[model samples]
Target: MKKIFYVFSVFVLFSLVSCVTADNNSKKSADNSSKNAAIENILNRKSVRQYSDKKVEQEKIDTILKCAMAAPSGMNKQPWEILVVTDKEKLEKIAEIAPNASYSKNSQLAIIVCGDKNISERFWEQDCCAVTENILLAVEALELGAVWCMAYPSDERVAGIRSLFNLPENVIPLNIIPIGYPLTQEQPKQKYNADKVHVNNW
Candidate 1:
């Protein structure tokens, strides 16, 4: 009787341990799957400038912003704001200020991604940059095209965007992204460079 009870107790402990291990493995698998999906999206992203005349739906715009917001931020402050421009008049004015932004005229939508200066200036730029890249990748995942035009790094450009949108003093424009259905496909450039890699020490 003692031998049987001891064996039964050991079996129960083994089963509990096995259950915990299985749960952990399941969680790890899910995490890996999610990571793979994001990698696939990134690999397929391409920068697109020319766009068709069709307008993007509000739902799609919201989806793109949702993805952008998912980007990692400094201390999770998330000090970013987006100005979605669909009005032709406003877009035209923006294009005027951004002379090199002729693509804005053809784009069905334009998003002015801004970062709050109150947030650490050091991370603000990098945080906004991550958001912009996420936005581009999201657009590509949704079968749309977008071009990222720098606006904040330049004082004149930032001032123009702020005035155009009547933004608050705290808000600093970082990038101008024109989004729409692409008229032409952009080929991805080969960016691999083995010489740039230095393992352990440079």
Candidate 2:
């Protein structure tokens, strides 16, 4: 009787340990799946400069704008506006402002993302930055090429864009994004550096 009882107790303990181990394995698998999805999306993103001259569809533009608006804003004050430019003549004029941005002239569309300074000065840049990133990612997901060009902080450039678009005085230009179908394939960038990541104490 004593032997039987001891054997039964050991069996119960082994079963409990197995159950715990299985649970941990299951959680790890779920975590890994989530991590893989995020990594895949980030790895696939690339900054495309060369583009085809084909016009971007209006529905596609709307979808990209919708994605941009979904970005989180500071204090929930979404104070950003987007100006879409499709006219070839206007794009040429705008391209002249950035000497290095001759590629803008060939893009199918340009989006001038602006921030309303009247809403919250503390988060104006942050809000606009979030929206710009969203636009870039959305364009990439849609198999389009987009190049981000800085506009804010440059008084002359901001003024030029504002005057060109007849924007309100309170609206501030943040970035100019040129979007279109990619003419050249984007190569993966090898930018990872293990030295950049620090442990908990670092």
Number of the top lDDT candidate? 1
Query: Against the unseen true structure, what C-alpha lDDT does each candidate score?
Result: 0.88, 0.87
- Tell me the spans in candidate 1 whose CA falls farther than 4 Å from its real position: 1-37
Residue-level lDDT for 145 in candidate 1: 94
Worst lDDT run of 10 residues, candidate 1, spans 94-103
In model 2, which regions exceed 4 Å deviation?
1-38
Model 2, range 1-202, lDDT digits (tens) per residue?
Answer: 9999999999999999999999999999999988986677567778788889788998899999999999999889999988999988888878887544566788989998999989977898999899998898888878898888988888888888888889999999898888999999997688899999999968
Q: What would the TM-scores of all predictions be?
A: 0.80, 0.79
Superposed by TM-score, candidate 1 places the C-alpha of residue 87 at a distance from the truth, in angstroms, of: 0.8
- Residue range with the least summed lDDT across 10 consecutive positions in model 2: 95-104
